[model samples]
Target: MEFRAKTVAESRVETVHIIRPTDLNDAGRLFGGVLMQWIDEVAALVAKRHSQMNVTTASVDNLRFLQGAFQRDVIVIIGRVTHVGNTSMEVKVETYVEHTNGKRDLINRAFLTEIGLGDDNRPAILPRLILETEEDRKEWERAEMRRNLRAKQRKEGFHFYGE
Candidate 1:
């Protein structure tokens, strides 16, 4: 079977949401879980767009919370495919908060791995990612490194379930 390569631009997705009082914590800041949910949703969209197949979240890495967002602030989430394997893709997600004064501050960044699934729910081959710009190339390289590290960890019997 043959699959057409897709550009990173083709899989890019951006979403914006306004923080509400209910979305905030006792300290009046946006909750980390809410941001993580948005990140996963956006990243899944990017993976599905890139592969044109059903995708499932395999893991999330380096989910850094850099800043706090207050209620009524606009939260912007951007997701783009950074790398692709035969059956998986890596997406980088960045979240920013726009204040009332129109200043945007980055609040969080993360990388998510998604595995493509066929109709039978088995691993499905994914289309290759075409890096169009220098930034895309750099991101691809970084994603490759992370993938390798993950594989090595798996080989070393690294388990997340705390068995």
Candidate 2:
């Protein structure tokens, strides 16, 4: 089947949440695990939007926690497709703390690789990504570099998880 190409804007996702006590860690800030889960969801939403297919996360790269968020803080998350491969797409997710003044402070950033899944639960072809702006183009180029680095690492027998 010929998949339709989708623009980065088409798959962009934004979500907001209030940090709760249950979502906090020992230091009284948002838990890292919870934040990671939220990031994963955002990335998955972007990939699914771009692919129009069920998707699963294949890998996560360059996850950087820049700051901590506390309880009662309004958190904002934005995810967008940076690039697409034959079967997978790269999604960049950014988490921010929104202030009452409508300003946002970035707290975390992560990139995820998600693969489209066919009805049979195997990898499926994904639609190509249309970069609309210079920023999008730069993101695509950066994604390409990350992809190539991952490939080289894999080729050199580097696996964080046991094969």
Candidate 3:
């Protein structure tokens, strides 16, 4: 199969949702898991757009919740493919919240690695990620470093303490 290079903008995705009471925690702030679900969904969309094939989440890195989003706030999620490998791609997702008073704050950021899958349920080749802007280039470099670290960990048989 011929793989064509695609720009980050070509596969970028954005989603918006309002934080409802059911989405809030006991403290009245948005639940982290809920936000994570949104992030993963958006990132998956971005990966699918870039790969044009069925994909699954391989891992999520550096999911940091910088701030909290209160109920009734508008949450905006932006996701874009940062780097692509033979059968995998890394997508960076950022979440922001806009308060009723019109104040905007960054809530969370995460990098998700997704592996494209073929009909045989094996890894499938993905389209190349084209870095068009300086920011895109920087993100690509960072994704490469993260990928290398993950490989090293796997090679050393690293596992979480509880696992």
Candidate 4:
């Protein structure tokens, strides 16, 4: 069967937030959990914009903390939908540290996969992912492979129920 790719919908607002003491670790660095929370929050907003409904974090792939963010540093999170499938959306997210007060550099990068669910709470297909750039194409291929691999694993009884 022939099908078309579902390109990403325009996101309403690229949300931004600052790190507070509550979001920092005992060592005075931005906690990894804090970054994950922000990532999830932004990703959810993007997914909802595309899906027009509530969504949840289905999985996260290859999350790397390349550098550390201090308490006063601004952790900028950039998110976009890289791919979409029946009820699933793959969001590419990157974290950058804007610390003119400290030193400006990219602190981290990560890929997060979120699945859109219907009221019944099952995997729902949303849109087809359309790729343009060679980099976007590469990531789309990777997401496709991961999606297929995960589907195969699930069918083969490798349950990732909690994870």
Number of the top TM-score candidate: 2
Task: Order the candidates by TM-score, highest first.
Answer: 2, 1, 3, 4
Q: What's the TM for model 2?
A: 0.96
Predicted structure 2: lDDT: 0.93
User: Which lDDT tens digits does candidate 2 get at residues 19-114?
Assistant: 999999999999999999999999999998899889999899999999999999999999999999999889999999999999999999999999
Tell me the spans in candidate 3 whose CA falls farther than 4 Å from its real position: 100-103, 160-163
Mark the regions of model 2 whose C-alpha exceeds 4 Å error after superposition: 160-163
Query: How many pairs of residues collide in each model?
Result: 0, 0, 0, 7
Show model 4 residue runs off by greater than 4 Å: 1-6, 101-104, 119-121, 148-158
lDDT of 3 at 89: 91
lDDT of 3: 0.89
- For model 1, the run of ten residues with the poorest summed lDDT: 154-163
Q: What TM-score would each prediction reach against the true structure?
A: 0.93, 0.96, 0.91, 0.78
**Predicted candidate 3 versus true structure: per-residue lDDT over 7-72, tens digit per residue:** 999999999999899999999999988998999999999998998888999889999999889888
CA RMSD, predictions in order: 1.9, 1.1, 2.3, 4.0
Model 2: how large is the Cα RMSD against the reference? Answer: 1.1
Provide the lDDT at 20 for model 1: 94
lDDT ranking from best to worst? 2, 1, 3, 4
lDDT of 4 by residue, 1-163 (tens): 2234445546422555677889888888889998888888888888877776678897777789887777666667778887777767788877787666655477766677788777687766675666656877887788788778888988999888694
Error of 4 at 140 (Å): 0.6
